[model samples]
Every structure is written in structure tokens, then in C-alpha cells.
Target: MHVPDGFIDAPTSAVAGVVAAGALAVSLRGARRELDERTAPLAGLVAAFIFAVQMLNFPVAAGTSGHLLGGALAAILVGPYTGVLCVSVVLLMQGVLFADGGLTALGVNITDMAVTTTVVAYAVFRALLSVLPRRRRAVTVASFVAALVSVPAAACVFTLVYAIGGTTDVPIGKVATAMIGVHVLIGVGEAVITALTVSAVVAVRPDLVHGARGLRQRLKLRVDGELVDVPAAAEPVAARTSRRTLWVTGLVTSLVLAGFVSFYASSSPDGLEKVAHDKGIDAGARPHTASGSPLAGYGVKDVADARLSGGLAGVIGVGVTVVAGSTVFWAVRRRRGTDVSPASTAGTGV
Candidate 1:
């Protein structure tokens, strides 16, 4: 849920901002360990995909609806540190470009949505992977469970934030119940999308999915009634082919979701909006600073046709997000490369 400007006071907002900043700083370093050529690009695509899917909100209850939060998806697809950066990038874009999330509440949104969701989802994913059979199915199952939990965890985090900074007098318990309840439904959708996406990636490019990296079971041969594991070179060349093909496929799918499928998404308010309207939680909400921008509501300013306006917005958002995310990730990767260079390591390896 996007917390608007007036929802949280300056003091609380500042605290959230500091926390978010610290988390982001830590993610920057963690991402260095996570990013490689293949995964770096995927990180950017994950952000773009999250930005795209968020445009397609589906109705849930009377006034509430749900959309992809992308924390688990990103973590499963890329890695947790990079996943946090991905969702944070999407939040940043929505706040600055589309006027969706409030500028003043950016930190709150990042902390509750980005930090909490990524941490919880990744933790669940890793824990599940550790216990379950290290097969493709296990990765998918872990992705589903992680995604399912991440949403409700985010809802709880939001309730806590609201409890601390909310301008309204509503009971915290009610807010928590409503937030978690609706978000649980949203979590199901998140789990399905995440599992499907992660499965697809693991199928094509298991190496690309960080969570599935070591889960690839080595082929075994029975020799003298004993099974022996095969090494990488012994595998068929076709089996070890580069995943550029799958990367292209996933990228194409992301484009289709944003460029075409998004047009048919529901117009109803999402879970947060519905709950806020029903509970009078948004009574103190302030208009977004960019609400007056030409591209205010996910539609182009002067584009009269609703479909055309929204379509154009979605397309532009995808382009901008991809470019922005790619640039950031590429920079992170480059820094990592420099750090690992032989020249740089020469002096330290004595």
C-alpha cells in the first residue's frame, strides 16, 4: 500500500527514510555479490516487470483489489539484495514519474514494501529450499511459499507503520486484521505468478535463477551396482547451452504483459485503497505532489482515449524502468568486476 504524504508525520517519515537509506546501502553491497552478466540484466527486467504488472490491478472485495508486489518474484528470479533494489526502483519510479506513491512517504513505502517483503520472502525461500528436495519442483514450491508469505508480512509491517504514524484514531487491531486479511488473498496471486515465473526461468536457465543455482542435480550412472555423479564436462553440450534463448523468451513475455495484456486488467481499486476507503484510514491522506503532472493516473496527459492513454503510459513506463534499472545494475556489476580484477587483486594476494 502506498502511504501518501499526510498519513505519517515528519518525525516518523524521517525515521523511515534513515532506515530505508541504510537498507539500500546494504543492498548495494549485497547486490555486488549477487550480480553477474546474466543476472544483472535480469535484475533490471525484474524491476520493469514489477512496474508493468503493478499497472494491472485486479479487484478483490467490494472496493479492494490486488496486484503483484514482485518481492518474491524478484528474489526468486534474481537475488534478495537485488530484489530489494528492484522493488525500490519501481516505487521510486511510481512516486517520481507517475505520481502513484507519495513523495513524502517514499521511505515508508520502501521500508514496509521493499525491505520487509524482500527479507521475509527470501528468508522463507532459502529456508524452504534448505529443507525440501533440491529439485526444480522444490524451487517452485519454495517460490510459492515465499511469495505467499511476503504479502501478508508486508501488510503487517504497514499496520505497524500506520500504528506509529497514522493520523486517524482507528483501532490498530482492526487495521491489522483488514490489512492482513485482504493481503492474504493478494498473496495467493503473488505466489502463483512467482511460482510460474520462477519455474519458467529454472526450466530454461536454471543458472539465471540465483535461488536454483546449486539445486541442479547431477546426472548419475549406475556402475558396478553403484551410482556415480557426472561432472559438468560429461553432460551433453545441448544441456549446457547458454540461456540467452530463455532470457529472450522471458523478456518477450514481460513485454507482452506490459504492452498488451495489461490493457485488459481491472479498473477497481487495489487492496490498500479498498481497505483505506472502507476504514476511513485515508482521511488524512494528502494529494500526491505529482498528481497534477500530465501523466497523473497511469494515462498520458492529453491522450483522450482511455485505452490509448493507458497503453501509452504502460509502454513508456516499461521503457523508462528498463533503461533506469539496467543502468543502475550495470553500474553495480561494473563495480564488482573492478573489485575482482586480477590487477586489483595482485597486491592483496601476496
Candidate 2:
């Protein structure tokens, strides 16, 4: 959930910001091992896609809706480390441009949404992969379960954060109960989206799916009434398209989703908004900084038309998120490419 400003104290928010920044720093290093020539290019697309889907909120409860949190989908499609960076990039773009989340509460959002979800989802995914059969189905199943749990885990984590540094004098127990209860229903939507997206990716390019890596099972045979291990079969190469083609395709898909499809999304308030209203935690909510901007509130600044304004804002947001996310991922990929350069190695030897 995108926690607004005034919910948490400045010191706690600052601490969260530091924690998120540190985690991002570590993820940058870990991403080097995860992203290669094949996957690095897709990483940017993943971020853009996440940004797109997050805009289309679906109905959950009577008045509450939920959007795709995307931690599980990103982690399984890309890798955990890269997934963290992807969601963070989207959050940053939404905050600084779309004003979807508050700038002052950026750290809180990152800690609860990016860090906590990614960590829990990936951990659950890895554990599931270890026990489940090493097949594409297992990956999808794990994605579903991981996404389902991640949302509630994040809700719990946010409740804990508010308990520690809540601006209001609300009871922690009530907050926790409300938060978890509402978010659990939201988790079902998360699971469905995560599973479907992961399944789609795995079907097209299983090789690009980090969680599906090394999934080809070893051969087994019965010899002398005992089971014996045979050599694992060589996995077939995926029909992966070129990075340029994938990027273009991904950006096009994101544009289609946000620029057009988002118009049909439910108008109901999301889980967090509903819970905040019910629990009175939203009493001190501050106005968004970008409220005065023309593009604030997901509408175009002077576009008198509702559909046109919303469509334009959505288009701009997708374009901006793609550009920003692609830039960040491309830089990380370029630096990684340079780090393993032959010329640098030759110089080192000399």
C-alpha cells in the first residue's frame, strides 16, 4: 500500500529510507549475478509492465479494490534482487511524477512494498521450488502461493511500522486486525495476477525466468531392482526473441494497458484506503504534493474531458516509467558488462 505522509514520524521515516536505500545498494551488487545479456534487457520491460498493471485496480471487497503489488511476479520472472530494484523504480516514478505515493513517505512505501514483499515472496518461492517438482508448473504454483502470502506479510509489516511510529493514538491491535483482514482478501488478487504473469513468461521464455532456471530434472532409472541416477537431459534452448524486440513489445504492452485498458478498471477505493477510512487512520492524511500539478490525480491538466485527461496521464506515466526504469537497468547492465571486460582483465594481468 502507498502510505501517505503524516502517518509515520520523520525520524522513523528517515530510518526506513536509509534501510530501503541500503537494501537497494546491496541489490545492485546482487543483480550483477542475476542479470546477463539475455535477462538484463527484459528487466526494464518487467518494471514497465509492473507499473502498467499497478494502475488497473480491481474490486476486492464491497468498496475496497486492490492492484497488483507485483513483487512475486517480478521475482519469479526476473530474480529477487532485480525484482526489488524493479518495484522500487516503479514506486519512485509514481511518487515523483504521478504523485501516487507521498514523497515524504517514500521510505515507508519502499520498506513495506518493495523490500518486505520481495523478500517474503522470493523466500517462499525458493522454498517451494526446493520441495515441489522441478517443472514449469511448480514455478507457477510457487508464484501463486508466494504472491498470496506476500500481500498479507506486507500488511503485517506496515501494521508493525505504524505501531512503532504512528502519528495517531490509535490502538495497534485494531490496526493490525483491520490491516491483515482487508489485505488477505487483496492477496487473492495478487496470487492470480502473479501466477498468470509468471505462467505467461515461463511459457514463452522459460530460460529468461530466474525462478525456473535449472528446472530440467535429472534422469532416473531402475537397475538391479534399485533406482539409479542417469545423466540429466540437456535442456532445449528457448525461442527467445532479441532484446530490442522484447523491449519494444513490452513497452507497447504497457502502453496498451495503461493508455487504454486502464480506463475500464474499477473506481472503488483500494484495500488500504478502505481500511484507513474504516479505522480512522486517514484522519491526518496530508494532501499529495502533486495535487496542484496538471497531471495530478491521474488526470491531464486542462483536458476538460475525463477520458482524455485520464488516458493522457496514464500514457505519460507509462512513458516516463519505461524511460526511467530502462535507463536505470541499462546502466546496471552496462556496468556489469564492463566489469567482465577482456581489456580490463588483460590490464590486470600486466
Candidate 3:
């Protein structure tokens, strides 16, 4: 959930800002190990896709709706470090451009949404993979469970944050109960979306899905009544879909989802907003600093048609997010390239 300004006091928010910055710094280094030529570009696409899917909020309960948090989906598709960065990029774009999240509370949102969700989801995913059968289907199953748990985990984190720095008179117990209850329903939607998206990617390009990598079991050969591992090169290689084709397809899908399909999404308030309004958590909420932006509230200024204005905003968001994400990831990838020692490069005859 996007925490708005004034929900948390300046001191708490400032501490959260430090935490978010520290996490981002760590993720940037970890991402260097995760990103390569293939994954770096895909990382950007995943961010844009997450941004698009988040716009299509599905009804979770009476007057409550939920959307993709993207932590599990992104972690499964890419690596966890990059996944955190992906969601963070979407949060930044939404805050500064669409004014969806508050600028003052940016750190709180990042801490709750990006860091907490990614860490918890990826941990659960890895745990499930360790216990479950190592098959392609298992990846999708783990993704569902991971996504399901991450939403509630985020809710719990937000509750704790509010408990510490809440500006209103609401009881912490009530806030926790309501936040967790609604988000539990929201988690179901998150699970389904994550599983379906991961399954689709695993089907088309299992190579691109970081969680599904190494899923193919090694071939065993019986030699002299003893089983021997077959050489990896002896296995038949599957024809791969080109990265360009996959990237183009993903971008097109994101455009369709945000530009047109978003119009049909539920108009009801999301899980956090509903909980806040009902539980008096928004009593101290302040207006977003970017509320005056032309694209504030996901609509273009001076664009008369609701459909056209929202569509343009969505399209522009996707475009900007992709470019920004790609730039960051490419720079990370380049840094990784330059990390090579000149002696090593010389030894390799590069």
C-alpha cells in the first residue's frame, strides 16, 4: 500500500527514509551479481508490467479492492534484489508523476511495500522450492504461496509502523485486525495474479524466469549397472524465444493492460485506503505534494475525456517507468562488466 504524507510523523518517516536508502544501496550491489545481458533488459520490462497490472484493481470484499504488489511476481521472474528495485521504480514514478503515493511518505511506502514484501516473498519462495518437487509447476506454486504471504506481511509491517508513529487516537489492536483482515482477502488476489503471470513466463521462456532456472532434472544413464549423470551438452536444447520478441510482447501487453483494460478495473478503494478510512488512520493524512501535477490522480490535465486522459496517463507512466528502470539496470550491468580486472581480460584474450 502507498502510505500518504502525515500518516507517519517526520522522525519516523525520516528513519524509514534512511532504511529505504540503505536497502536500495544494498540492492544495487546485489543486483550487479544478478543482472546480465539477458536479465538486465527483462528487469525493466518487469517493472513496467508491474506498474500496468497494479492499475487493474480487482474487488476483494464489499467496497474493498486489491491489486498486484509485484514483489512475488517480480522476484520469481527476475531476482529478488532486482525485484525490490523494480517495485521501487514504480513507486517513484507513481509518487512524482501520478501523485498516487505521497512524496513525504515515500520512505514509508518503500520500506513497507518494496523492502518488506520482496524479502518476505523471496524467502517464502526459496523455502517452498526446497521442500516441493523441483518442477516447473512447483515454481508457479511457490509463487502463489509467496505472494499470498507477502501481502499480509506488508500489512503487519504497516500496522507496526502506525503503532509506533500513529498520529490519531485509534487503537493499535483495531488497526492491526482490520488491516490484516482485509489484506488477507487481498492476498488471494495477489496469489492468483502472481501464479498466473509466473506460469505464463515460465511456459514461454523458462530461461528468463529466475526462480524456474535449473528446473530440468539432469538425465541419468545406466552404465555397467551404475547410474551416471549425462553430460549437460548431450541433452537436447530447447529453442529459445528471442529476448527482443519477449520484451516487445511484454511491453505491448503492459500497454494494453494500462492504456485500455485499466478503464474496466474496479473503482472501489483498495485494501489500505478502505482500512484507513474505516479505522480513522487517515485522520492525519496530508495532501500529496504532487497533487497539482498535470498527471495527478492518473489523469492528464486539460484532457476532457475521462477515458482518454486516464489512458494517456497510463501510457506515459509505462513509457517513463521502462526507460528509467532500463537506464538504472543497464548502468548496473555496465558496472558489473567494468568490474573485470584487466589481467583477467587479457588472460581471456578479450
Candidate 4:
């Protein structure tokens, strides 16, 4: 959930900002090892897709809606470090451009949404993958389970944050129960979206999926009396297509979802909004600082047509997030290459 300004006191938000900054620093280094030629470009597209999908809020419970958090999907497709960065990019874009989340609560949103969900979901996904059969279907199943658990885990962590720095007087127990209950329903939607997205990518290009790496079925050979494990077969070179096709497909899909399909999203309040109203969590909420911007509230200013205004805002958001995310990842990848060149030269005495 995107915590609004004033929900948490200044000191706690500052602490959270420090924590988020530290995590981002560490993730940058880790991502250098994860981003490669095949996956680096897709990372930006993944972020843009997550932004678009988030705009399509699906109805969950009575008067409540939910959307894809994208942590699990991103982690499964790209690396966990990059996944965190991807979601952080989307949150930053939304806050600065559309005023969806508050500027002061950026750290809270990043900690609760980006860091917690990615870390928890990836951990669970790896653990399940270790125990389950190594197959495409198994990857999808693990993605589903990991996403389901991550949402509630983030919700619980948010409750803890509130208990420490809440600006309201509501009972912590009530808040916890309501947050967890509604988020559980939201988790199902998250799981379904994560599984489907992971499955689609894996089906088309398993090599591009970070979690699916080294997941091929092991070969078996007959020994003295029983079968023994052997190395897997090498993939055929002709089976692979240039990455341009995949990139174009993803971009088109994102454009369709945000430019058109988003118009049909439910108008009901999301899980967090409903809970905040019912549990008094928004008692101290302050107006977003960007409320006066032309594109504030996800509608273009001076645009009379509701559909056109919202559609333009969504498209712009997707475009901006993609460009920002891609620039960040490309720089990281180039730096990694630069770092490796020196080591190779030293090793070769060149």
C-alpha cells in the first residue's frame, strides 16, 4: 500500500528513508551481477508493464479493489535486486507525476512495497523451487505461492510500522486484522497475475527468466542396473529469436493495457483506502504535494473527456517509467562491463 503523508511521524519516516537508501545501495551492487545482455533490456519493460497493470484495479471484496504489486512477477522474470529497483521506479514515477502516492511517504512505500515484497517473495520462490519438481509448471506454482505469501507479509510489516509511528489512535489489533484480511483477498489476485506473467515469459524464453535459469530437466542414463543422473542437453541455437521481438511484444501489451483497457478498471476503493477509512488510518493524512500538477490524480488537466485524460496520463506514465528504468539499468550494466574488463586484462597480463 502507498502510505500517504502524515500517516507516520517525521522521525519514523526519516528512519525509513535511511533504511530504504541503504537497501538501494546494496541492491545496486547486487544488480550488477544479475543484469546481462539478455535480461537487462527486459528489466525496463517489466517496470513499465507493472505500472500499467497496477492501473487496472480489479474488484475484490465489497467496495474494495486490488491490483498487481509486481514484486513476484519482477523477481521471477528479472533478478530480485533489479525487481526492487523496477518497482521503486514505478512508485517514484507515480508519486512525482500522477500524485498517486505522497512525496513524503516515498520511503515508506518503497520499504513496504518494493523491498519487503521482493525479498520475501523471492526467498519463498527459491525455497519452493528447491523442493518441487524442476519444470515450467513448478515455476508457475512457486510464483503463485510466493506472491500469495508476500502480500500479507508486507501488510504485517506495515502494521508494525504503524504501531511504532502511527498518527491515529486506532487499536493496533484492529488495524492488523483489517489490513491482513483485506490484503489476503488482494493476495489471490497478486498470485494469479504473477503466475500468469511468469508462465508466459518462461514459455516463450526460459533463458530470459532469472528464476528459470538452470531449471531444465536433467538427463538420465542407464547404468549397471538403475538409471543415473546425467548432464542436461544443450539447447538448439535455431530455437532462439532476437530479443527485439520479445521487447516489441511487451511494449505493445503495455500500451494496450494502459492506453485502453485501464478505462474499464473498477471505480471502487482499493483495499488500503477502504481500510484506512474504516479504521481511521487516514485521520492525519495530508494532501499530496503534487495535487496541483497538470497530471495530478492520473488525469490530464484541461482535458474534458474523462477517457482521453486518463488514457493520456496512463500512457505518459508508462513511457516515462520505461525510459527512466531503462536508463538506470543500462548504466548499471555498462558499469558492470567496465568493472569486468579491468579484471580480465589483469588476469591476462595485457
For each candidate, how many residue pairs have backbone atoms clashing (under 3 Å)?
Answer: 2, 0, 0, 0
Name every residue pair that clashes in candidate 2.
none
Give the Cα-based TM-score of candidate 1 against the true structure: 0.93
What's model 3's overall lDDT? 0.91
lDDT of all the models against the reference? 0.86, 0.86, 0.91, 0.90
How much is 258 displaced in model 4, in angstroms?
Answer: 0.8
**Which candidate leads the pack in lDDT?**
3
Summarize candidate 1's per-residue lDDT along 1-350 as a digit string, tens digits: 77778877788888999999999999999999999987898888889989988887776677667999988888878889999999999999989888987898999999988999999999999998888987889999999999999999999988998899888888999999989999999999888888988887777678778899878867899999999988867754335546666656556666777767888988788888888888998898898999987777888899998878888888888888988999999999999987886776787963
Q: Order the candidates by lDDT, highest first — what do you get? A: 3, 4, 1, 2
Q: Which tens-of-lDDT digit does each residue in 112-210 have in candidate 2?
A: 898899999999999998999887789889999999999999999999889888888889899999889989999999999989888877777777789
Score residue 282 of candidate 4 by CA lDDT. Answer: 96
State which candidate, 2 or 4, has the greater TM-score.
4
Q: Compared with the true structure, what per-residue lDDT tens digits does model 4 show for residues 207-226? A: 88999987865557799999
Worst 10 residues of 4 by lDDT: 231-240
Per-residue lDDT of model 3, residues 207-290, tens digit only: 878898888546799999999989878865435677898899999999999999999999999988998999888999998999
TM-score of 3: 0.94
